[model samples]
Target: MQAFDNNLTSVIKSLKSSYGLAFFNNLTLQLHQLINADYTFIAKIDKERYISQTISLVAKGKIGDNFEYSLNDTPCADVSDDSVCIYPERICQLYPNDQLLIDMKIEGYLGTPLHDSNGEVIGLIVALYESTIINSEKIVALFELFSGRISAEIEREDKEKKLTELNLSLEDKVNERTTELSSALDRLRFTQDKLIEQEKMASLGNLVAGVAHEINTPLGVAVLCGSNIEDALEKLNSKVKSNSLKKSELEHLISILNQSEKSLSFNLTRAANLVDNFKEMAVGINTDDLMSINVHLWLNSLIGSLRPMLHKKSITIELLVDKNPPNFITCPAKMSQVITNIISNSAAHAFEANDDISDHQVIISAKVCSDILSIKISDNGKGMTDEVKDNIFEPFYTTKRGEGGTGLGLSIVHNLIINNLSGKLEVESTVGQGTSFNLEFPSLI
Candidate 1:
């Protein structure tokens, strides 16, 4: 009995931690060994409403050769109801010797109830022998002790299950919060970028308007003078029709008219060119979409677009494109933005106090070999200090802050070059002489 109690205690503790068919099967084997008996079975009340549930014999040792019984008529049912055990008498009544035992040659039996929580029996354990094994009150006491341990183990297992469910619920909540925070941050960044772009557009608009006013004044005066010359020509025609025109008078009129025409023509062409350049630089437009653009062509176009901005400060613009520029497919809008911003940076920062426009000169060039397109834009204006170059591409890091600069131009340019186009931008600068920007793009067609 001492050995039986100790092993039963251990097996109950193990059952508390496990579940399903495997737990019951092993429990039945342990119960058989504890009782020093052969043949053990574990059966459950598989349904709630049915009084008689099918028997599932989990482990069977060598005691009974074969046994059969009705689920509705078994000795184990009595113990299952009251958490007790039934012995040889009840077993004989359930399986009579003449009917069940004599055919099998002999019989003995013992069984204990297996309960779930709430003192409700879910199953029972049975042990069998081939001959008389006397039942005693000591045996009943042993069964009571084992039954209490099994109940405690089942309760502990249910608590552990609830704890596992709570942990999963808490983890899901944490993941949801992280996702929300990430989305909020992304939206905030997008709004910030929009504000910067708007600021740049405003600055460029003011510059364009000022330059247009200056050019229009000269153009308007030339047009007025041309009208006066036309009136003089009409007078000469009337005089000739009246047969009163002298050669000298005629020659003077013609000379005046010719001079006026040439002046007007030159001024108008200059004004138109200036207007075109301003429009190209000021407008937000992109061609080529995502086509494979020729690198040399793109370089020329980019310089032409920025020519007016450079001209405003008397910067001499020069292009030195390689003979063979490889074609590359990319977002033209993004590429144009990068070039415009870099060139504009020079216009904004490459000058110092009382810096003369005549001293400013900008040079742009490109070369291509195999699958690489390299471009360089340099200026001979007052260059940057080491400190400025270090943070040049940082958003809002400008020396010309109060001059209506948003400082996002270089940052946006940097982003477009690297993030959008998978390119790199490098810079070299000096305090007094000049600055240069080198950009490289892969020619991925």
Candidate 2:
């Protein structure tokens, strides 16, 4: 009894230090020594295939290796059905045709079902001898004790293998998802760059159209005046040929010539001024030249250029400047674009044809407060809802989609003010009352 207890303790200790096949081999060797048997082994049974694998075996004081054989006509087949099988002095009488028993010359046998964690039979622990065995009950009890530990070890190994496989699968999935996200981000950035370039081209086109419209009227007036002066000269030549020119007639001709000269000069000057303003705006758009200029004067000039577009819609713009405005050293061209986009947006969205109101007014007010420049542009037109106001500056979001509105006007303005000028933009609006845009930036004087 003391020997059995010492062997059991050693087996349990070996289970802690060793694992899988090594643990099973050590356990089987110990049990073989304890029982003084000719053979001791542990077999893993496959009930579905009717086969069993010898995981660990010891024979006649020598270590035996692992193997597999059919479970047909074997004592292990009976032990797998949740039962203990012990044949004392069988000597091949019970199963005469059992080839394994006949070859090994087993006279005694003891085996018990090895259950898994869920109490299902998976294998068996068996001890066999060439001679009839005494103390069979003791051997069976000892085998049952160690069998539970063996079952637990097998379960632990299976779980570890499954966990390792799961970790590998999760790692692969994470890497695949990361690669997909990187590709998506690259495509998105490319699309954004293209959209920004398109918006800039659209703004340039609007500027060109406005300048042409404004210059057309003055040029037409100048041409008409020139034609009238030519006719008056022809009449004076005819009078000189006849040599009958009166003083009153000569005075009338002079008066007519003076009026025509004044009209031609005024119109020509107006056309020249329009050309100069357009050239400045074009230069500003194409280059990033910084200059120190009066804020009041610059803003009023930009508004004047945009007036041709606004006037067609009968939209009236009013500019209010501070008493003493500061000069700002900044990129005027970028600022011009920002202001143009904002005012253009209002002109397109803020007004309806109403005979009751004489003016669809846009008021632009500029002030310098505490070294900061504040410009407020407000329109008394149909205002925006809360949702529209919230997403107004988002790229590709527009209230006028499919109506030749690209939705990039305010988005470009926002990017220019915030990124180019290091400034802030905010908006206030009521659904029916009006909308106001407040812009502020540090005046680098």
Candidate 3:
């Protein structure tokens, strides 16, 4: 009993300080010396495969290397099933066909099953001798005492290995997902920029088409008047060449010439005025430079250029500017784009629900108060609901998504007003009443 207690204390001390095959071999060696056994081993048993792996082995008073063998016809297999097995003096009487036992001349055998926390047999500890063991019970007791500790160590190592593999797998998945999300965000930004560029081009195309349409009328009139004047001059030259001129005939020719001159001059002046307005609009839309501009004069020219487009929709636009509104020093191109997007948006959406074309009106009024410039553009058409108003400025959000509305018009307008022009924009609307956009900006930016 004293020897058994001392052996247990020594094994516990060694196990607490060290680990791995060396620790297991040292433990088996200590057990072998204590019992005076010729052979001692600790084996892990795979019950399903009927295999035993020798974790630590000792023989002939020396430590032996670990190995594995079939457990089909071995005493270790029986020890795995039963808690303890002892063969004090077998002498080839039991399991005579067991070649390992015959070859090693092992007569005395004692083993204890190593059980895990769940009380399931997982391994065995065994001792064998060339002669019969005088104290078989003591050997079995010693094997049983340390079997649980060995099982615990094996289970702990297995769990730690699985946990390490799981942690590595989790980290890999997290990194992969993060990379995918970053790539997706980059793609989204690229697509957004492309869409914005497309919207700008489309707006410019519309403006060009409108200006072309507006210029056609006066140009046509001027051409007609010039043709008539040329025909009248040719007839007068023929009369002078013939040397047959009456006073009444000369007076009639002069009256006809006077009317033709006035018609030609009026039509030419109209054409020139239209051309000037279009030129100003084109310059404003293309240039980004900041310049001092008369608020009233600029608005008048912009409205004149847009009249052709408004007329096509049967929409009337009225502009009321203060007598002494302060001039603004800012980028006219960006402001023009902002205003154009707003009016275009109204023409496309605000009047779609209203059937009355006679009353369709867009009123633009501007005033200067202290250092601020305020512009109000209001429409007398079906207004918006709270939901539409809230998300109106959000990119890619629109009510007319399918019918050629890119939903970027208002988003561009908002960005231009806030980001480029450094101005503020607000909208007021009720479902049945009307819609009004209020714009305010510094006189100098």
Clashes of each: 0, 0, 0
Instruction: Give one digit per residue, the lDDT tens place, for model 3 in 1-445.
Output: 7867787788678778767676788888888888889999988888888888888899887888788878776777788786587889884578687788899888988888888888888888888889999999877877777777788877776688899999999999999999999999999999999999899887777777776776787778778877877887888898899988777888887887788788778877877876776566567565677777778877777777677767766889999997666777777677777778888877888785447645778999998777677889998778999999999999999899889888899899898888877789999998766799999977556
Best by the lDDT measure: 2
Distance (Å) between predicted and true CA of 135, model 1? 14
Q: What pairs collide in candidate 1?
A: none
Q: Pick the candidate with the highest TM-score.
A: 3
Sliding window of 10 residues with minimal summed lDDT for model 3: 277-286
User: What does candidate 1's lDDT look like per residue over 144-229, in tens digits?
Assistant: 66656545555565678788898888889888998999899899788766867685564455455545665776699688867878
lDDT of 1 at 295: 66
Which runs in model 3 stand beyond 4 Å of their true positions?
13-111, 116-120, 125-136, 244-288, 353-358, 369-371, 443-445
User: What is the descending lDDT order?
Assistant: 2, 3, 1
Displacement of residue 296 (Cα, Å) in model 3 is: 2.3
* Tens-digit per-residue lDDT, 207-254, candidate 2: 888788878998998899899899988899999999988899889988
- Count backbone overlaps in model 1: 0
Off by over 4 Å in 1: 1-162, 185-218, 234-246, 270-284, 289-336, 352-375, 380-408, 411-424, 431-434, 440-445
RMSD of each: 10.1, 4.8, 4.3
When summed lDDT is taken over every stretch of 10 residues in candidate 2, the lowest stretch is 350-359
